[model samples]
Target: MELSELTIHKAHELLKQKKISSLELTMALLERIDACDEKIGAYISIAGEKAIDQAKIADEAIAKGNISPLTGIPVSIKDLICTKGIRTTCASKMLENFVPFYDAFVIKKLKKENAVILGKVNMDEFAMGSSTENSSIKITHNPWDLSRIPGGSSGGSAASVAADLCLASLGSDTGGSIRQPASHCGVVGIKPTYGRVSRFGLIAFASSLDQIGPLTKDVTDSAIMMNAVSGYDRNDSTSVSVDVPDYTSFCKKGLNGLRVGIPKEFHSYKGLDPEVDLAVKNAVKTLEDLGALSVEISLPHTEYTVAAYYVIAPAEASSNLARYDGVKYGFRDMDKKTLIEMYKGTRSQGFGDEVKRRIILGTYVLSAGYYDAYYRKASQVRALITEDFKKAFKKCDVILSPVAPTPAFTIGEKADDPLTMYLSDIFTLSANLAGIPGMSLPCGFSKSGLPIGLQIMGMHFNEEKIFKTAFNFEQATEFHNKKPMR
Candidate 1:
């Protein structure tokens, strides 16, 4: 197998046997990025020199018989995550040139394990849009079909892994950013339960809704990444103080007694493509054949999920994004005559239309008179949504559904209609709103050859169940083994 295409586990085995050096593997991936990234537009920046230096350090450690799963593995990080001495642009002009002096908690963990950072990948501006076309820097096209979007705001993260530009990538999910893109790009992506991963140094989009997770070539790589990045961190107050299991150990076969819940609402939803519905239904039968039981379940408040998420996410985004005024770091308007004028001018020139739209919606929802009408009601509905998941979990171990309504759509299909774009994430928004773990892996392909994703959601911190189920399904099918011809 080509070095760049090796999974994390496979590469580590070869490195352990001294068949390959960290420098050699890192160079292979860097070369792959160099050759293909122009067409993929996966990276916002590439840390070639620094990555080589890190790979050398990993080689020294490996020579001394010390290594980790991620040691010397070339990885890409979504631009929203901060890295010390690396420019972490959230694909917005406001912080296009901003460089952080401190690394995010996840980056610190990856660095400690000696993972070679291939640098930042692109995303929607401030992670506010469903399609990567909202990115101010560059539009990331789907590797499957260059005419379609790779999904967003983690489009680059998913595309990078799908195209083998990087072995794996870290992507933050807010209202389905990670899973949706992974679904569209035909790769494995997981969003752990809220607080399962630390959020410090993650550029805030919706503080309450955002959670960082990995997008990889398969479920095993996802587990390897989970093992490396999951755990408590004092830097983030929301970081849950709990034991993180070795996620890799749970990538086992046989779902003998596992109960898979199928929400009727999702399958019956309007606008769902027939191919995606049939794919997910077939996946359910596959699980049944594997000795699993499929139970028809209902997340009763499912219809309110999108509305509630839009209100709550935007409200939090408004509060969290208030610090980006020109007075502080990031882009500034030097020609403004007054402080207020400067703030307005800088933000006006900095943020993109999608970001400005969310900020406006957020500010409006949080306004004095409107707070009780919109934000407060949304919060109440959010609680109901969370409770619905809790109740559904009582009937089954994990919930299974389609990740999106359809496979990747054309680049400009929904760009002009914001509501249509928002609905693209309907199946995924509930998981984020309820703060549960969710994942997407390739299930099948549409007639036109676009990939479809099967979403598996676990209650709270039960990511092990998600990993196990996805791994089992992946092994039973050949979808995960297929790659887009680049």
Candidate 2:
């Protein structure tokens, strides 16, 4: 395999054996990005000289016997994650040139491991859209088919991993961003339980629902990444102070006696594509053949996931996004004479249309006269959704479903239909709402050759269970071994 195509574990093995240098691996990836990123539009910026310097430092550390699983490995960062001295534009003009003075909690951990920083990848502006078409910077194309979107708002992260532009990448998932894109691009992605990974430096979309996770080339790499980034952080108030297990150890645990939950509602979803449904069902049967017990369960509130999530997520987003009012360090209109005009001009010109729509919807829901009818009802529904999952998990160890209702559509297919775009995450919004661990891995392909993803969900902070289940399925199928023919 080409050095740029090497998985994280494979690269680590080569680096540890003294058969290859960190510089060589870094150079190969950089060359790949240089050759292919223009067509993919996966990155917002390239670290260039800084990455090379870090690789040299990693090589020196390796020579001294200082090594870790991630040491000398090159990885990509989503533009929304703060990196000290690097422009952390959340793919919006508001903070287009903004730079941070400190690294995010996860970035700090990666740096401590001596992992070479590749660069920042694109995403929906402020992570507000599903297809990545809303990114103010660039529209990231699916490497599998340039005419289609790679899913979003972590479209760039998944695309980069799929295209081998980076060995692995970090993405923030508020709804289905990471998992949906990973499914579309035929890669592996996992979103840990809320607070399992710190959000200290993640640019907030919905504070309560947002999480940081990894998108990798395989399930094993996903586990290695989880081991490095998952932990409690004093810096983030929402971070849970719980012990994190060694995720890699769970990969080999077979599915014997594992109870798989099949929600009755998911199979009956109105818009579920026939290809996606068959693939997910086949995946379940494969697990059963490997010794798993399948049980029919009900998440009664599953139908309300999209409605409740839209209300709650946008409400938090409106509150969290109010900080950029032109009075702060972000972009400001110098020509505006009045403070209010400057605030209006800055935001009106900075944010994209989808962001503005959510802010307006959120502001409307939270208004004094409508709060009881909208926001309060949504909160109550959220509680019910959480309860639904709690009751369902009692009978099953993990939940199985389709990551998305359909394979990736053409780039502009749903761009004009806001409600249709919202439905793209119908199957995924529940996990974020329930604050549980969930993941997406390649399970099958559509007739058109697009990828399909199978979602695996586990109870709160039970990522090891999810990993164990996905790992066994991965070992049994060769779907993940297929790459996009760019």
On a 0 to 1 TM-score scale, where does candidate 2 land against the true structure?
A: 0.99
TM agreement with the true structure for every prediction: 0.99, 0.99
Per-residue C-alpha lDDT of model 1 across residues 1-486, encoded as one tens digit per residue: 789888898999999999999899999999999999899898999999999999999999999999989998999999999999999889989998999999999999999999999989999999888779999999899999998999999999999999999899999999999999999999999999999999999999998889999999989999999999999999999999999999989999989999999998998899899999999999999999998999999988988888998899988998898999987689998999999999999999999899888899999999989999999999999999899999999999999999999889899889889988897789999999889999999999999999999999999999999998999998899998888996
The clash count for each model shown is 0, 0
Clash pairs detected, candidate 2: none
Best by lDDT: 2
